[model samples]
Target: MQDVPRIIKAASLRHLTLGLAALLVLAITLALPAGPAAADPGDVEAASRGVVRVVIIGEEGDQPVPISHGTGFAVSPTRIVTNAHVVSEATQDDTLRIGIVPPEGKGGAFARVIAISPRNDLALLEIAKGALRLPPLALAGGNGANLGEVAAVGYPMNVDLAQGLDMADIFSAQPPVKSRGFLSGERPSRQFDTILHTAPIARGNSGGPLLDPCGRVIGVNSFSADSSGGDGEFYFAVSLRELLPFLRSNGVEPTTNTLPCRSIDELNAEERQRLEAEQSQARERMAQRSEEMREVRDKARLTAQMQVLAARENRMALALIALIAAIGAGYAASVWRGDAARTTQARLAAAASAAALVIAGLLWITRPGLAEIEDRVAAALAEAEGGPAPEPTSPSTAAEGDLICTLVPDRSRVTAARTDDVALEWSADGCVNGRTQYGLGKGGEWIRVFAAQEDSAVAVNTYDPATRTLRTDRYLLGAEALAEAREARAAYTPPSCGVSDAARTLGEQQSALIAKLPDRPNERLVYSCTAKAAAR
Candidate 1:
């Protein structure tokens, strides 16, 4: 029996302990906040388009042979960045030529060394005129934090050696290899500052970009730490401290992204949540409005009934008074039969009594019917406001001319898109800036599609006059698809801004071009617009 009590106590204690643990777990779960959203994988691929292979070619007899090769990235459509050592031979020897191989394409273009700094090991090369244009990569304004995620994008020599590419294959265009790791720390050299990261790099990765999760350039890959120390290998990149000033002094202004990095999935989730909350609030407002309307209707019905009942009672009372007057007047006429002057007064009273009786009959017949309750209720509500009721209005559908549109960041998902105010001149017939005619899309918004020969992007722009909003979606294409888009653009001759018929035809052509585009764009920018005066 003693053992039984002890066991029971032990069981009770165990249960109490489990209950406390459950409560503690619940509290802790509630206390802990959500972690940051994950970075989009597409960011790396999109940024890799800017990475190129810098090949140093030398003349061997009548044929051009590659002497050395290194990696570089586009700072502008025409300018490229690489290590000074990669192109030093070309700068010294006129026979050695510099060839720029893009991530995608059949062949490479030639470039000339415009700037070189041996101390910083950074060199700038300008692509030849009429060469293909590469999209520029944005540079981060802030110094990246230690242990943050970083990615090295470049064309390493090991890949070429592993694939056993010949001289002809080496000079051809191919995508760069990507290595992802965490940033170690900032290791500033005696001459210049550098970023230490764990992302692996090889010989040919000399001047490639060290990118943040958002694909912004944080540094330029320079060299790697010696692995002979038994410690894990770490690579060093020329940090933005040296890279930014070098580019700025050379009159290069690449796009800079300062906003916090967020993935499309996270943006979409937040947008869904916002829409749900807005819908919930709308439902609540509708319920509240219904309650208010019901109250008004009840008050109006009660007021109308009371007024009708009061009128009916007044008519009955007046009828009784008229009947009494008629009886009194008849008695007066009989009593005044002997006197001529009094008889005339009695006859006049009798005539007035007949008129009163006729009015009473008309009043009794014309009392409001039961069917008039709703009509009277409506009239009473309208009359209470001192005028007739007004109809409901909707959003404006008129043309908005000479307007300035500002970016709405919260409602937008931007990667490499610019965050500047857009200027627009709109017409009622979907003409923009008095030169370009836009087609009316299925969604009732004005749309324009553009695909240029030199650029590797297809742009679709849409504007909603009702919401006074503008949106631009850019689809970055590879070499093959871009060629097709260029062909389509060449075939379609856009009409000038004029009649609706021309606008309709333009829309058909735009739709045809759109059909040839990819299903989705890599970046989308949304802007809310207002009149120019309001913007000022």
Candidate 2:
């Protein structure tokens, strides 16, 4: 009762204790890891791959000169996005040329402005046909760029930033610089929706990409706040809301990935986890299937054994009955001898006994055994488990006695023989042609492999599902064709060899090589082998 006042005083301080607790929580949250320090390095590298240095090459009297420069990135195979101001000279005058220097490569190609929006300060440039194709950067999803950890990827301040480098170094093969900062805010109703951030940029940094923590292009670096060399001043970018529409209007569709980006180390860890999960699932399924097969095989084997046992018992019973009859007949023959008729009856009874003994001996010799039944059950079980042969990898893979090769048939591989008239498929079992033995096995994308050859030549063919194109690369052997391929040669379908003049010309190109091979029977390409066809 005396302490009632003390207790009331303590109650009055309860609000103050709660306020302190709330302050403590705020402090903890602020102490958490922030910005670029927490972002993924792998994602930053991926985004930088699409960034390029834009050099506006202009004429100074007679000699060509690299005029003003800025940064840009690929949005499509042939289209680039940059600030309209960066390429203003080119857009205004046709003679002022635009050249794109990729982050990783030396040679660059000239470009022409395909679309421009002076109001939005955005411009689209198209590289000439057959130039180096850079990996296109995809815009963020419908949610667009928001306040989070961001990366600014581009080449900033030319000779000033990088010490002891001339203009040539600026335009050479070098990856863009990366800066990490927090995307803090946005301008609600500005021309060309703008995003505000603290990522550092300079004169040549304009038109670079502003990527989210997940490596998505959320915005493009447009301009910075009037810093007057202030350290804490903000920078701004053109958000995806305006960028997406601008690209679509100009007939370009950039790639997009909504998946969250992780550091390379983290990504590898996740991949290992996924593979382990799938392997475990596959093992479980195989075990279950094996158990089911065992049960079915056991039941069938048991039924067969029982039938055999029953058959043996039936033969024994018949043999026993015959023996008893034969014994009785033989005894009757021994005891009976009264007249000439009686003697004849006795002889017949003896003959009947001999015949019965012969029949019993044959039955014993032909009895069913357990070993034979076991062999049959094993064979049936093996058949249930995917037969005895290994599955092939590609349509054209083979291994012969002394050689092994994996061949892919392009229509160009065929000359005088047209595709419609000839079949170029491989057999399921495998085949052999000349010194080369053809075999198909599961694994690898190699088109040509010569295991015994001294020349370490190999051909690799990669296919893109999006464009439905196949690109082939031959290592030492195709060096002569490299120039032609670099110029233009991804898809290779030969002209029809339907007794045409063009076919005759093309055959000459392949004839010299084809003539060198040693001829062998069944040397033709085999896609499938039918039992009926084989029999013929």
Best by lDDT: 1
| Candidate 1 lDDT over residue span 435-510, tens digit each | 8888877766689988866555788999888778888888877767778888888888888877549867888788
The whole-model C-alpha lDDT of candidate 2 against the native structure comes to 0.58
Candidate 1 segments whose C-alpha is farther than 4 A from its true place = 1-39, 323-354, 379-401, 426-431, 434-446, 453-455, 489-512
Model 1 lDDT at residue 14: 11
lDDT of 2 at 44: 63
> Given candidate 1, what's the lDDT at residue 125?
94
Candidate 2: worst-modelled 10 consecutive residues by lDDT:
410-419
How do the predictions measure up, each by TM-score?
0.83, 0.58
lDDT for each candidate structure: 0.77, 0.58
Report residue 32 deviation for candidate 2 (angstroms).
9.3
Residue-level lDDT tens digits of model 2 in 157-178:
6433457665546567677888
Tell me each candidate's RMSD, in Å, in order. 15.0, 17.3
